[model samples]
Target: MLSILIPTYNYVCVKLVTDLQQQAERLECPYEILVADDASEDAFKRENRKINGIPNCKYIELQENVGRSRIRNILGRLARYDFFLFLDCDGGIVNADFLARYKALLDKADVICGSILHPSKQPSPDVSLRYTYEKHAEHKFTAQKRMQHPYAMFRSFNFLISRSAFQACPFDETIRNYGYEDVMMGLALGRANVSVLHIDNPLMNEDIEKNAVFLHKTEESLRTLYVHRQKLGYCTGVLRLYGILQRMHLIFSILLLYRLLRRVIRRNLLGKRPSLGLFAFYKIGYYCNLAKERK
Candidate 1:
């Protein structure tokens, strides 16, 4: 009845898979779990190889590491069941009835977004950047708010999509990076007129990297976002504001102001318990810097 698909990269997912398997067993339905290793190291390989022996679960180790978007596309293609349940390796089952809630939503919408939740408490100092940002900006996304911006809010984590809808608009494989791929997929689904339903059921996101790693990945995603902005209908929202600034010949002045504040903003973001508002400014400055570099 469902296919639980997870893409792992050097992360141990034994606990996650076990929780999902137990839930599926309780449902008493036909289900398969697929875990693909994206060419991780020996330690992860040894641990994840255990999945190979599990019943109704397949473990595939690719010789080469395909980036985030392609790996998910690969998982979708490998899924045998009609409904595909995509979960990140770092995510944990928030509740025992997680799968059941998703199953109930199957017939109601073409795509389902089981929301994301962070731990109520903060993680360690080293890995707090992702936690802080998610807690402030993303983790609290309400079902009502998501409806207003379905395309922008439709993240790729803990969601169920039928085979027909997935094959209609698979993730863009050209995006071979860490960030904004979910945004890209959401945009595609919206353009195709696919209906998305949001619910309170959430996955506990456990993967938290150091501040430095988070910033690097954020910059990488910004690069990808700038490159794809045109394809994503660039002349909307903030882009419209930017276009107006460009027309009035104020972009250079704005860029210079951003450049002046970039270092101060970066200092705040890289520090302990950083401000997400400052980080947003940092990202805007970084993306604007990239945009200026290209011209």
Candidate 2:
């Protein structure tokens, strides 16, 4: 039996659950759906309640909000089956034969990841551009690759793993925020000599709006990336060099920073305000570090 684990936040979309229901009903093999909700204020819990009678569907509601990585870890521990298929609440199985495909690959891989595609939207060009970038980034790893380069196979949206792999190596809870948790988890699996398989099956993403909350999450993600690098003892030389290039080219830096500031403002006004001034300061520091490295 396969245990399908889904971690949800403040999402109102009922289609995610409905799609899973359809997939579960049609699957020839035995499978269970576990929905771990992170205390959403909206009617997400109530909406989920409607699906309680569905066969093999279990819903869990937390009293408080825990970050996505931690919630998934909790679900991993509670999973009753040896194999686990983790899906984001906004993601759905595009291929009806998804479970079968995973079963075929489980013996050879500790981890199996699928592709994620974007939905069409006409109004928001910025949002569309971001989604396009994300889609291309996630689709880049649809083949077998070395485990040492775990970042190449990382995507939190859709993937399958053996419970044993997680039992031996679990997600880093210190990656308490949203962004780099997937990368850190992948790296951990890689360090443990776990093999990852990337399948061609596409997971369709539901429509998601770009808002303040999403932007805040992005900033948190970058911060988490910084933390991950620190833990891994990876040098920030490349990042520092990029920052130096920005400083040496004033006009280009202004334009680049303007674009970044605009996107940051649009997506994360609620979070710490990222000012052009502070960004310039960061660039100066980055350049100084690069110069020190040269000496």
Candidate 3:
């Protein structure tokens, strides 16, 4: 038996339900879908009731917004099966055989990870650009490298793990929020000597609108970095190099801002609008902050 666990917030419940329905239809074996919602203030509870009629789907809404790590940990503990598949509410099945593929290799590895891909088009330019960049980064890994690479810590969008492994090392709720919980979990699994198998299956990640409250999210990322730096002693040389790159990226960003303004004034650009590439700046800033915390 397999338990498909999803963590949801706010209005994303609609897509979450739809994706689960698709997964249920496509899966060849029996599975239960569990949605652990973080007490969205929006109409998700009402919406969830309307969709409760869907088969093999269970929804649990909390009284408040507990962070993702805690929510997932709760789901893991509550899951009925010995094996669990963790899927982001926004992720959907790419092929009919995705569940079967994971099932085939369950005995050999403690964790099996699937690849994440983006849809062909997106509703918003900002969202489209972000998806395009992330898709590029995710696909850069080969199956072997993805399975064993040290950098695999950077990804956690799609994966499967045995309930026993999860029981041995549940997500670090101390990390809180969204950033490094996945990395910490992967590291814990490594320490336990659990084999991580990367499946070469493409999974679709639906693009969503970027939140206007971006700075708040960045702060969460920075907090996560601080915790990671404390837990894992990253090398000093790498730390110094990270600071230098961060400053360089910030300088280049100011220059790029001016260039972007000039182009916008010259003519109306069609197709996808260019992003300021602030994600790189955020990453560099995170590394720099981590380095500072270490000092």
User: Which residue pairs in candidate 1 collide?
Assistant: 1-30
Taking every candidate in turn, the Cα RMSD to the unseen true structure, in Å, is: 1.9, 6.3, 5.4
Model 3 local distance difference test score: 0.67
| Candidate 1 Cα lDDT to native | 0.84
TM-score, cand. 2 vs. native: 0.76
Task: Encode model 2's per-residue lDDT on 1-295: one tens digit a residue.
Answer: 7888888887743566667767767766678888888998756788876556667788888998888788999999889989888988887567777667777777878888877766654335434434544544554454554233555457778889899898887777776677767766776776788878776766777754453444445555545545465564442433455455657865355445545565454433333333334434443443333334444
Overlapping backbone residue pairs in candidate 3 total 0
- lDDT string for model 1 (165-200, tens) is 999989998888777788778888988999898878
Clash number for every model?
A: 1, 1, 0
What's the lDDT of the predicted structure labeled candidate 2? Answer: 0.66
Give a tens-digit lDDT track for model 3, residues 1-295. Answer: 7898888776555655666567667766678888887887656677765555778888888888879789999999889988888888777667776777887887978788877777766657645445545656655665766755733343467788898888987888886666767777777787887777877776677744453234346456666666566564452323345546566665355335534553442222222543434444444544454444566
Better of 1 and 2 by TM-score: 1
Q: Residue 141, candidate 3: how far off, in angstroms? A: 3.2
Candidate 1: stretches off by over 4 Å: 138-140, 235-241
